[model samples]
Target: MIIRTAMAQINTTVGDLEGNKKIILSSIDSARSAGAGILLFPELTITGYPPEDLLLHTGFLRDNIRVLKEVEAYTTGSDTMVVVGFVDFSLEIYNAAAIIQNGEIKGVYRKMNLPNYSVFDERRYFTPGSRPLIIMSGSLKIGVNICEDIWVPAGPTNDQAIAGANLILNLSASPFTSTKNLTRMSLLQTRAMEYSCCMLYCNHVGGQDELVFDGRSTAIMPDGHRIVARSFEEDFLVIDIDTDQSTRYNLLEGKRKGYCKKAEVEEINVIIPQRKHQEFLPEETYRVSSEEDDLIDSLVLGLRDYTKKNGFKKVVLGLSGGMDSSLVAALAVKALGKENVIGVMMPSRITSDESKKDAVELAKNLGIETFEIPIESVFDSINGLMRPVFSDRTHDVTEENFQARIRGIILMGLSNKFGWLVLATGNKSEMATGYATLYGDMAGGLAILKDLYKTQIYRIAKRINEQTGTEIIPRNVFLKAPTAELREGQKDQDSLPPYEILDGILRLYIEESFSLDEIVSKGFDRETVEYVLRLLQRSEYKRKQGAPGIKVSKRAFGKDWRMPITNKYRD
Candidate 1:
């Protein structure tokens, strides 16, 4: 027997019930047209992943179930069994997958593991299931599970396999990180080999707030061969799996592992007739993307989805010709196109001629709309008004930050008048150390590089120029020393350490959670480590008020780093 399975890696909007219904129905039609015996979709396909507090509403849950029933009605007379994710409201709500066939729900599989770690609060909304589910279609025994169910070593997948399941179907909304796909693939392959079954993994695609899901939905064969879908984009993949191969491997493996006669699990038998083997072209394994490519793609998708979903067609950013803003401008153009990106150069008296030249050069190269707003007169006017209050104080960081706040005001004014979303340019290095001024550069609707360190910004910039085969970001932007140019002859290194060293210590402390002494043991200066750690803690309040940004790293500041603003513990 041959089972033709279709995995729809889809992009869904939270609380968009009608929109999600259309997508799910359209995908079901496409799958049925391809003669797939079974179809799989990503987790939370009806309501979207991480619906957050929206789940608290009773009407939202009822509406989601209504959409699921509509889907069930649409699948009437079709032999294809659809496994779709939705919120099930029994006595209590559950993160669930409903197995629909022949116009009625055959069975429902509630998620066993509720992940409550970084970016996930499933435990708050869902009741974990204690029973494992297996679907029986003729000789094929398939296991159905949700995301995070198969991640554990001894999760429900173990029970389903012991019950003689030859195929495992997992629906996921796994968020994109730089190195997460590699880890996910390895885990899937290990499960396939150990269980003597093919693993079908479907993940959501597109950005929801700061979380972007890279939909690399894959089919891992029992022999460890994989057929993958697209990355950072929605894709529909259909593949034929030979049951003979799986059955043979399962027989040997199950007997070797001393398979039990009565496995503790629930079984739902559905009559899904096997479709005739349609010889389609073999699917090639997706090419391994370079780290630069992954980072660029994730950022572009995140920005594009956020802007579009939020109903903004244009984006505005302050371009200072420095690395952070310049790189952000380039990415904005890539995501929203040159016509929709507005580059505003709000130069004050201290702004250098070289900086002005670099900013203009970048705008011209990228062909984005440019606005040269000189803020010196405005700065002087504000300074004169504050001269009496500042009579006791001399020139210091206060005067320097006045310029940044002025530029921020201009950008916000443009955004307000033109309905353009302001994209904050501050990266993780500045955000981590509280180097950015509140209501100043940190003022925006979205922060593009909040999860990325300063050194990582330079690397991405280099990669952009290298791939485009042109100096799109300008050569001088890379050559010039980093600076805010708020005062005369100022460089970032004057206040903060070199990015190479600062970023190294930050990675250890923030991502690795290394203590001060442990970080110092990694060859960093003790004083510098202590200073960086202190700045990180001191800046927690600032980060709480900053714009939400895309998360492309293992640990982002939002939702991932949860430190109290008034904590007194010093490391």
Candidate 2:
């Protein structure tokens, strides 16, 4: 009864069947090499967790179940038993676990509980499964649950326990938001102690938009000691259990179902050599990084995945001599290798010599491709087209924005021709305050650092240089005060408050969802706080149109940060 179990807590992209299958196979091989008999994967590991609207596509479900079968085939002829998650659609869709042994599909268990609260909308996509599976893996009577199934007291596990299950395994794609681990650990202990069975919990790892599955996957003994545990940011867990340990203690009984069916004490214990036990190795607990480090790491991870997933070998970004573009160019070099990132410096009439020099030096230092595209002639032609109709007003923000749009259009044209996904570099500070020119800097498929504030952007830049120890970003870029350079000496601070104050207020207001009065009461000047609040309140529509930015914080301006744009409620 020396049962060996492994947890492959991996990071998966939504709808990435091929990529996920590859990663899963690698983990399975690793597990087999480690002499593990049973390996557990996260919920929806095949088609990725929370496939969202993709579940609406009939073809997607058809394909996902097909992939699960192929995965099942790969596990053939090996002594290892795999219990991985995927969507199963017969008459209806189900959050399911496909248990495979020797290349044959043994038993499939549909998740009994579908959590439909907050971030989860599984009830919308999947029909509730009725039963828990307790399959035979050597001497272990292994009961299987998915996510929320074990969190509840009475459910499929009760039936399985009644049917004689000595061990319960739960698979999850549980998200991290403050204090989630504490809650999970508390419930796991309660479940193991109450059920009088060893519990194995496996979860997904890494960032998926705002939802980062902290894969602190654990295995609790019947006596409530966490015997096996793995940490966040992806890893595998291996647990060794003495199955006969259950026979060493008395069995406790709970009702078979929600109803008062007669309780039965069911215990199945097979003998094992009680010689040695594998000690649990605990990984260092992760502390949240500074805001800038968080944002930078998020962008790097997002860019790496987006490019790698899309089958792009190189990244081509338009780097202005300005902060936004400079930040993006540097990040691209980091994400993709420096050789794979190409930077284009497009200068208009407003471009400074310092800006041009800085851009060139940045590309040179990073060893990336840098090309200059001056658009003075393009602007002159566009101005000639508009002059006949607009004779009265002198040039303003519109004229400045026309240059930006031309840059954007040209950059996209290059991206189209060269197969580069243009990375827009508008920070959250600009996006929230509407400092970005529509169809101008906003013209890109992915926004590399959009969720970051301007201050956070600088911090990230500084941190990058600190890590690299070379002159990647020009020193002047860091030393000089911030400006969009839209017009003659137009600065960001001229329009918006100081980034220190602005980002501070924004974090409390946007991420924390603080009211205006409450934010003002946090020892900030009332008028500035009110103005910033009003700006944030009004610019929801613009943010909705911003590029797909990497989510680093608990509340990014993505699906996780939904608000009504037409709402009249304000302070």
The sequence of per-residue lDDT tens digits that candidate 1 reaches over residues 18-119 is 999999999999998998889999999999988998889999999999999999999999999999999998788999999999799999999999999988
Give the lowest summed-lDDT range of ten residues in model 2: 266-275
Q: Quote the lDDT for 212 in model 2.
A: 52
- The C-alpha RMSD of each candidate to the native structure, in angstroms, is 1.3, 4.7
TM-score of each: 0.98, 0.82
Residue 108 miss distance in model 2 (angstroms): 3.5
CA-lDDT, candidates in order: 0.91, 0.76
Q: Specify the poorest-scoring 10-residue window by lDDT in model 1.
A: 254-263
State the TM-score for model 1. 0.98
